[model samples]
Target: MEHRITLNAIAHIRSSFPEKFGIPRQGGLADTRGNIVFEPEYRDVQAFRGLEEYSHIWLVWEFSETLGRQWSPTVRPPRLGGNIRKGVFATRSPFRPNPIGLSCVRLEKVELDTPEGPVLHVLGADLLDGTPILDIKPYLPHVDSHPEAAGGFADRVKEYGLEVDFPRELGAEVTEEERRIICQLLAQDPRPSYQQDPARVYGMRYADLEVKFTVNHETVHVVKIIRSMPD
Candidate 1:
């Protein structure tokens, strides 16, 4: 059996999430979108002949941020209050032996002949900007889903959502779709589980805007929406 292997990025996803802090913990949690641009070497159109027929796809990507970090056997899961230690293999921790990740996202459209090569417009992807994608596969709902399966310790907080109090004037700064996506993202409560300071504001970058908010009780109040020059 082979003990080691090498893999190259076939495509890279362009997303609004510039960092890992605010992205949803799982795919399909928000309606944010991203475009998958294939590398020149893997840009052949024939490779994706039947890909558009699927409504959703799976992304085999790398935990690019955790590269070079040592893999630990146990990890403090943020979902578990960040104090309880559990085996890393049992959790979806990025700092693992393979440094790989899997995400299931909706395939909005497949642009076959874009200038950037074949581009895939996807939605509800929990991925970072410019994330390297190793592989892609159609999500077969009949074979892949196990709705009745137990979630073990993770089911305890599966219903977590925050009340978002976004001001109307602030919502006018972006398009209707952008406003809706932002609200959905904020409702997921992107703050770390260990943080509980209601007065301390947190800022997250989404697309070209900086969203600033504070959590008061279970409600998240949007304090400001600042637009920054694109880098």
Candidate 2:
């Protein structure tokens, strides 16, 4: 016999990312800030009581864009340099039998009693702005924190730092703090390892500036950054 499950969205994340290509492959990878605005119907101020006690929360959401009417059994992971294929069930690739995604985000603060309703201030969210959130649960450290947990296939993942050489013309417009944040973000190496063409310039928008960088081996070196013009 076949079983089925049904889920509903509780809120939607509001972030600066509008495209899938640039979203950090994993949530909380950016260490950048964003907001999780609950739907008006679920925005009861009382519902948030004691939520501030926890520093992080788990988000259950859908890969809404990855699904249609079909599914694939194999996928290429960017972590694997996007070359070799892997079984969909073994990887977090979005093209799964069920396109569900999970993320653990740090809770910065909770703003309550607002005219619009309660809002959750979150940090390090890799979710795109307006990504539908299916459910939220407080992270229980005693149960969730497992230092010995084995991360298969991803065990070889290496940490890297950014080598940004900001252009003088653009550097003058960006504040020192902004530069620091951008550098930290680029250090995570946002590009797929398979993509190693040095001549290509890749960019992503953070706050008010458009940051461009190139990858050489394991290094992500910043090339230029400009203040984004207002739309």
Candidate 3:
């Protein structure tokens, strides 16, 4: 016999990452901010009465874009240069059997006076705009914290912080908050590990700007910044 499970979306995330290309690989990788807007039916303040006590929360969400995509036993992770294949269960590939994702994000504040209902402001979230949230649970440090846990292959990978250079003129146009977040994202080296052509420029859709950059080893130079037109 087999059992099936069904879940309802309690809230949705509102973020600057409208697309998936430039999203950080993991939550808390960048100081990017997002808002969790509860669904009308689940907007009661009583549901989140004691939620503000926790510093962090876990968001169980769906990979809506990859919902219908086929799943494979193995996947190529960007961290591995997109060339080496690892067991899908060992990697955080969006192409999963269930198309589900879990993220731990900083819970900044909980507002109960929103017009639609209660809203949760979060920081360091890597979710895309309008991502459906299935459940919200408070993170317990005493029970969840495991300092001695091994990271498996992720621990063996050499990490490098890319030096990001934004042109003075274009850099001036970006706000301090945007600049900080963008730089942090670039520091993580947002490129396929296998593609390392210094001459080749990469375009990433970030927020309302088209960020053009080129990476040559340890450095990422921002060549141009084009404002995306409104839809």
Candidate 4:
């Protein structure tokens, strides 16, 4: 076996999700948008030549926020109500031997000429803002599509969409676009699967705005929206 291996980030993701707390567990769960800005060294237009032809692309990225942390072989997946432990290999838990993640996002567009060089606009991404990307590969439908694939225990976990109600006064703070994205995130039920306390108010940060909401039965009520103070 090779003694060691190394990887470098070719680009970084700019997304609305400024923090991890409210991000969807997997890509495509929410209609979140993001952009991939290539690093100065990899800014050549040739690097992304013909990339626009593909509708989706696979992103190989580092869990930078969780790097250098110890990992366990068994992990309690939030999908399992955060109670049942399963082998790390059988789950998509971020805490693993290698702090890496793979996600396939819809490529909305690719701009070759920009003040910052080549950029790829994508949709339905679950990545946090400023995530370092190790590599990007076009998704091949013939090879990547598995129509009959079973998701094991994951398939057994039923998905539940929540109703989002943002009062006009509080919702007016954000633009129409931000309001839509906020509703989309809350519809996917951002609260932990194990947490069912209706009285508990959850706060999620997105693009410098703090969204405060509470879950009452199957509905998520937006309580307030506050602009974050400059650091």
Candidate 5:
């Protein structure tokens, strides 16, 4: 077996969350949409020939932010209020032995003739913008779906949800569709478990908008929304 191997980026994900702050802890938890833009050398349409028939695909990507960081044997998960430590292999923490991450996203459409090459539109992705894609594979529900599968420690917080109170007047520039998406993103509760200060307003930079909100008990109140500076 090869102890070391080289991997190249086949594509990069373009999503609303450029930073890691507001990303969901797991994939398929939010309604966020993204585009998987292929790299120059791997832009051949033949590569994704039958991919359109599949409803979902697995994304093997790099943990770009933790590229140069060292891996720890144990990590404190935010779901557990960062108090208890679990083995790195037992958790989905980005800091790992291999900075490789995997996500299963619903494939919405396949644009074959775009000037930017063939692009795959996906939904329910929890990845950051410009996240490098290492590989892509079709998700076969016949074997992938496990209704009775146990999720281990993560199951305790599987039902994560928060009531979002987003006033319509906050971001008038945001389209109705965008407003709905923002509300869904906020419902996922982006704040760390330990930070429960109701007065401490937190800012989430998603796409072109800056969403400011505060958590008080079970509800998340949107305090402000503004157009952010372009990347």
Candidate 6:
């Protein structure tokens, strides 16, 4: 006996990330800032009725970058310090029998326009730019949120607060709103758990400012923030 599954792309995400390496490991971890451009054929405004009532939506997408001719049954999860291997089904690793990815993102707004027809303004998406979106479903909090959910081997991961120090030169350039977003992102401690080097500088673009930091074990301390000068 044989079985088959066919999926179609309904939309594509437009984001700042063109590469996968730096994409957030999980959705809702990064600043909410991405757009979903629906295929022109599916752009009927009537299709989006009452969607605004939901704060979040679930994106079922293909792991386009990880798909291969064969798949391994076991995968190394970054959460496990990249040392232990886990069964593919037991983890959310992209290298699976089916390279499907799930992300729950905040729905900022929706627009019906001429270019892409209908576009969904979403925040906190971890997907790369031009990622194929297979389906969209409203998040049902009652069914999705679990207070007692177990995290397996990842339970021991440490949470650290970011220590941000703004340089005087750059400090004067940032707007209040930009600073708030940077603080929010830093509070989450964006560095990988396996990374412990204190000398390495990591930077990410937040609005007009370039934030750089170093991780000393579980603690993330800000090193520098340079605001790009206006052209």
Name the top lDDT candidate: 1
* Candidate 2 lDDT, 92-133, residue by residue in tens: 877878788998989999999677688888877878678889
Root-mean-square deviation (CA) per prediction: 1.3, 2.1, 1.2, 1.5, 1.5, 3.0
Residue 101 local lDDT, model 6:
93
The residue-by-residue lDDT of candidate 4 on 60-169, one tens digit each, is: 99999889889999999887888999999999888989989999999999999899999999998999899999999999999999999999898898686889999999
User: Which 10-residue window of candidate 5 scores lowest in summed lDDT?
Assistant: 154-163
Estimate candidate 6's RMSD in Å. Answer: 3.0
Best by TM-score: 1
Instruction: Give the 10-residue window scoring lowest on summed lDDT in candidate 4.
Output: 184-193
Return the candidate ranking by TM-score, descending: 1, 3, 5, 4, 2, 6
RMSD of 2: 2.1
**Clash totals for all models, in order?**
0, 1, 2, 0, 0, 2
- Model 6 ranges off by over 4 Å: 172-178, 203-211, 217-231
lDDT by candidate, in order shown: 0.92, 0.79, 0.90, 0.91, 0.90, 0.78
TM-score of each: 0.97, 0.89, 0.96, 0.94, 0.96, 0.82
Instruction: Indicate whether candidate 2 or candidate 4 has the larger TM-score.
Output: 4
Please provide, for model 3 over 1-231, each residue's C-alpha lDDT reduced to its tens digit, 9 standing for 90 to 100.
878998889999999998887788889889999999989999988999999999999999999999778999999888887878999999999989898999999999999998979999999899989999999999999998899999989998878688999888988877888888888988888887888899999988778988889998799999988886778
Give the clashing pairs for model 2. 15-129
Model 5 segments more than 4 A misplaced: 229-231
For candidate 2, what is the lDDT?
Answer: 0.79
Candidate 5 residue-wise lDDT, 62-180, digit = tens: 99999889999999999899999999999988899899999999999999899989999999999999999999999999999999999999888746678989886885868887887
2-115 per-residue lDDT for model 6 (tens digits): 799888898999875655544666788767488998887778889888888999999999999886757789877776677878898888988888889999999999887657
C-alpha positional error of residue 224 in candidate 3 after TM-score superposition, expressed in Å: 0.9
